[model samples]
Target: MKRILSAALTLPLLAAVGACGAYGSSAQPSGPQPRAAAATASAGALPTAPGSVTIGSADFPESELLAHLYADAMKARGVRTEIHADIGERAVSMAALKEGSIGAIPEYTGDLLAYLSSASTARTPQDIYARLRQAAGAQGLTVTAYAPAQDADTVTVTRATADTYHLSSIGDLKTVAHRLAFGAPAPTRTLPYGLPGLKSAYGVTFRQFVPLAPTGTITQNALRNNTVDAADIFSTDPFIPRYKLVSLKDPKHIFAAQNIVPLFRRDVLTQPMADACDAVSAKLTTTALAELDSQVANGASPDAVATTWLTATGLAH
Candidate 1:
């Protein structure tokens, strides 16, 4: 997976990514900020029954934007959709998926795999996607093709902090770990890719662990405000470079390669829906994804941004 680039998400993720696309980031569920698409032809969350089909996303702009991409693509195929946006934390959405509340969501290969199997040894994209498919299948889910784009979690520090500490790799923190505070999602305490793993793999033990929102923005903000010395910001989040944050290197490969993919309910994946997402996925490279994120951050609506991307890439007309 690292051969190309890196990974982010929104909650229990069963941490999604309490994974990201911050997947390269865990839970607390938020209520649905449902953004229902106008009724059209049918696809995406291809419901076998009568009710409206819903696509779910974690509480971050990237995830929401991903949901919009799926919706917009499906719309082009004739299916309208309701986005169960901001479906808080990991557990709630995982439960929702199991119970049929949402049919699909954008996910990171590594993060989703990590969330399902913390003990897994899979690493490469092939291995990770294979593992993830198994894990998701057991839960009655189907994963669409993964996009080249990724948004892995990065142990980011402000340029000032990086300069002050002479840090570049995550292992560098070991020397000053005891003096600095770490900010991330609440579940970081237990997630293999978070504090405990960092400590075990890199011997990193921060002076404090601030439980920030799973939303990369909050944690990234805390890093900027000096509320926390280092935070887990998504690799593709435009704010990283904008803020001049330094993403510490992971020499030990603590974080897995987290490529973006579609995680969906098996029953909801019609051929048209799957084909539409796969078409878009084929075009979603890391650089393309970062630009899409930048657009939303600059105030473009997720739907608008997604539509623009689809049209530009000729995935949609």
Candidate 2:
């Protein structure tokens, strides 16, 4: 049987576990965090263990759904699994993993690598994963095969705004940006990959900066009402299609790659378990992820959404 443990119930249990060491200083990069490759064998494939497994997720819908996917699939393969959903940010969740409160969690490649090594210059998926494996290994964790699905921080505008400015990519925005008001999370106004990187990488300088919620109706409404010309939105946000918004391409890789992958503790991962998780990765795509997210946003439970996908892909019975 699978169980979804509440934070209140789980935090006390995890309090006795020692820290995995600080991920980094609190002055970490302020990038969008709530956010793969073809199916391949896991890097450190080991045999299935007879013991139970504990899975966890960060405090986000998509991540919670993924935790269910992993737990249900593992259970199908005869591993007893339970989920600790909404465990807070990556740092908090990672601490739980290190202390044995949980064994696995879904994670993004580039951001995880960045958290591990702030100085990492990895841009491509392969480069980022390689660096991530090394960094994660140091923390007693392992990154399994990555899914083809990817999500990134994107500069988005209404279709009308794109048409009016003849914008097809971030670079094109440079020409008309000076006349437009840009909106995004308040921290993005100064983050290295936010306004600063936008200016340096694409020569984009908006007429004014409009602070708005990162991914919600507030930002969408702002764009729809023309209060801001463009906003920083996640690629996986379903609102992009529903509102007919256009996401400007980032050829310069300003936001970096964020392919989905499972990050788990080394002791609990076996070859069979690794392969089972990889099967899920093989079937997930960016389009599929967005659609699933749409369902969750519309009030569907993450567990139900995940079970449907797993059954459809023949990963669960």
Candidate 3:
């Protein structure tokens, strides 16, 4: 999926048939607390148990970064950590969490809520987090502190049309949508993040809707070349700036906040490891994440990009 992001024409289709995790509510655990402040390392790193903590990530770059940070932080706490990245789709990832095949992974609050309850009401980030905490606790997962970075749903328009019509928000596109072409993943037309919600929320009926690849090299090029006037992009996509395009703000906030957050098994996150994970969350911001995504989209490896950002942010030394 990461490789598919680079080419517009070859973007893979998202499996939108069902929401994530079909497990029973009885599987959920009980009791969780807010993350604690980062404590100073007393002396040598904490002691590792006999077993290892498994960290998993979905196929996205940001998820991979969060997984790397979690693994590295656990290592700093004297825990043996293993990262299982690119672990298929979200449903599979959630099932792994339930079965305890992996200890931790990155997740979004809004997406979590929708997956858990299948609700359509767009809650604020705070509400979403609290709701997910209770829901995930029952599932035996703990959602640690949420990071400042948000890679939520976004829509973008070519610079040509944006500048020509003074368009800035999704609302602005309604006036000129008939003259525009929409390009995005085919799933976008059906998913809440795509055309269905787009039309319902913004009343944007475009001149055409074309299936393109993910929001990386391919969809970006289509937008840049005016082959598609608009595309479904992520808020953290690097090409938003590179292509000189404008992201139409969802003022109505139809899309929920998809902030980066660590989801770990309760047993894996000892006090020291929890604190380290919290520190990484505290320092990450949307702007910084976008820059990192740019580096990867520009051809740098995700591992290299994650390592560089971790070192620079003092999350790793």
Candidate 4:
């Protein structure tokens, strides 16, 4: 989705997303700790076993769906595969990639960039991916070219909550954020574009921070059921429109461009396998991804969704 931030956003806050700590109330809480920090002992020190072909995913529907697509495409090319679904967020996912627990996983370019360096100023998709590629290369990871499909993070609210707070943009939450409870995946609370970004960029802090699961269903249910007054949701999530939730504008580009991509361990990525993944990346557009995600969210198995899309695109038969 193309975001057009309204004129209401203050000009000075434009720089808040990049280098903060100077802009806000300084109430940034230490968010959820990543689960992978414990396993870094073997990271980069040992090579993944040569005979294995495993794909992993973050603990969310889209990530799992993408994993299924990649595995199926590789399988069609005579490479057998196994999937490790719901493997937590970037921290855990990255650890899996580093230690060879997983040969590959689905990832977003900008988010991966931010994880490497939260202060990075890469904005456009090309710049972000280039920076991400360089950073990832240094760590023995390979980043494939990104897809047209993007799902930038958004600070969303129910229509009722939006109306109550007159919330139209991220900046609009500045005044009443303290009274609201914010919900999102554990990693988001600490990500620069998540709670910290909100606090620095908009001087927004909530009454409480609820570290919920990364799954869209669980996150959306919390919002719809009033478990939390606000949430950080992905832009392409089907529930954004289906549930009539309002995704607030981000004029500062805090969340940045998040095109879909595959992250592979350098040792595990072969020419044929990389090409198989790239074929899917080239064919998977935002609209196509949304449909696939919707099917999975509504009870269709990710294997089934992957089969249909791969068959239609001629990536698998």
Candidate 5:
């Protein structure tokens, strides 16, 4: 559910890749780094010092909810924790982590991988997590176990549109695509899994391309009003069900796996701290995430939603 800001959209993918690579190469000033030294501690091991940690989240509600889940669970295990939500996007949040402003943040595996290494070829959850761990390590970060829940980029259309066009999958759009308009964030037009990949992978080409905001508002309105026949929506967006939209299946795996995971400053993670976060991942499921998103979309507080889920799952008493 991360949105690439319009300013970033101006850069070509290759240029952005180079910029990310350069940022990764810059050395961080030595100070009190996260406790990555305790990484060898076995899963479920207690942290040497349980009472000192800060949890960070991105600008979105789901990320905030995830942050709460981690923070609450760690607190349950006697880890001193603080939540810093709405801390901006990955770049800003990651900077905060490295500078010791935050100990950990909720992250999506595929996106993290792409940010760390744009040339990454990892696609499935396991492969993406493996590459993400290695890449994060190089940048002085530690990645915890990934949850089954994912919020991936999806090509979706109104149920009416799907029925009319007999579109059940991305491949089915090949024949009717030329007659339809497509909508998504501006950068999606060039991202490897966006417009270019759609045509190359499925031989589907739209009559027109519309650039819309990633908030789901613009794209949803465009699709609902018939201004655009289809749009790129997040897989976990509650509006999809509210509007009865059909998310076309991507048998060709056009988008990379984006399982939710914890990315933290290596120096801050202790064996017990890692285990506490991993326990959350072990119980989190796609259905649960969708329901939580729906509740938040319906006006529930992110912290409330997260707490309810954690309690229900026995992660919090």
Candidate 6:
């Protein structure tokens, strides 16, 4: 969806958390292990199954595609694996990993940073990945090299509203603030990147704020039907393009960079596994991501879409 957050909005996400604790210490995975990583610890080590891994993904079409990609990539490495698609939000998914329910989960670098530490300054993708990897390590998780694709946060308005108000940036909404109603995830109303930044960066506040529908469809429909003037939408949402909505530029960078990364439990990042994941990250890209998303949005079965993509991209035989 969206890529890098401009420097301005990036601050809030960073400011919300402080320095992440050191990651060398990680939460150990649950269950029996094939081999012990060290002399005395049975936990926090990869299973000795040698060539098998489990990957988890969050809810949403893009995530499903990613899960497929990861599963396919690992399969190519001669690794047996399971794909746990739609594992809910980050917190829940991370919990799944921490509990050893799944070996690895895709995460956003900025999100992990915000979760680990609250500094808001702009950091290039490379830096973000390194930091996440290090922080994840502390929790007994490892952030594998990040992928090229980034589904950053986006604030969007109806195409009609944008044209009518000449609202081009988050700043422009200030003048017409009273006339607009914004809808976002329930948390955005109070979160750092939520209303506070709108007040701080744009000097504007909405006449009303509504809860984003539990599923994105409701929010998307609300925006289309004019039930809401604006709403939070991911940069790559197929509906954005399909509906011809106007994606307000986040010149202030309120949303953080959310590059896709695999967050692995200690058991999954053995050197060979890490290298296999890196290959997937290197090949994945925004354009490719958009295409995979479109397949599901267009109504193809997820498995069929994932299968086609894997073969076409040569990620799977």
The top-ranked prediction according to lDDT is: 5
Give a tens-digit lDDT track for model 3, residues 31-124: 3323432121222233345346788878755567668876776566666788898786678888898788988787776777677766546445
For residue 287, give model 4's deviation from the true position in Å.
3.7
User: In model 1, where is the ten-residue run with the lowest total lDDT?
Assistant: 33-42
TM-score of 2: 0.83
Task: Choose the strongest candidate by TM-score.
Answer: 2
Cα RMSDs, all models: 9.2, 9.1, 8.2, 11.5, 8.8, 10.3
- Pick out the ten consecutive residues of candidate 3 with the lowest summed lDDT: 18-27
The digit string of per-residue lDDT tens for model 1 on 1-317 reads: 21111223322111111222222222101232111111112224445333235899876677888888877787677665789888865566778888998988878777678777878897555567767777877777768777766677568888898889898778888999899998876777787778888899999999999988665567666877889998776667676656666777665566776777878777776656766777777777655777788888777888899988888877777
TM-scores of all predicted structures: 0.67, 0.83, 0.78, 0.63, 0.82, 0.71
Instruction: Please report the TM-score between candidate 1 and the true structure.
Output: 0.67
Off by over 4 Å in 6: 1-50, 58-62, 85-101, 117-127, 270-272, 297-299
lDDT tens per residue, model 4, 140-248 = 8777667777666667789999899898777898999889999876766687767887789888989999987555667778999999988766666666657777777
lDDT of 3 at 78: 69
lDDT of 2 by residue, 165-194 (tens): 898678898888999998876877898778
Q: Which has the higher TM-score value, candidate number 1 or candidate number 4? A: 1
**Cand. 4 Cα-lDDT:** 0.68
lDDT of all predictions, in order shown?
A: 0.68, 0.70, 0.63, 0.68, 0.72, 0.62
Which RMSD does model 4 reach against the true structure?
A: 11.5
TM-score of 5: 0.82
In candidate 3, the residue pairs with backbone N, CA or C atoms under 3 Å apart (3 or more residues apart, or in different chains) clash, namely 8-218, 28-138, 28-139, 29-138, 29-140
Give per-residue lDDT, candidate 2, residue 288.
Answer: 77
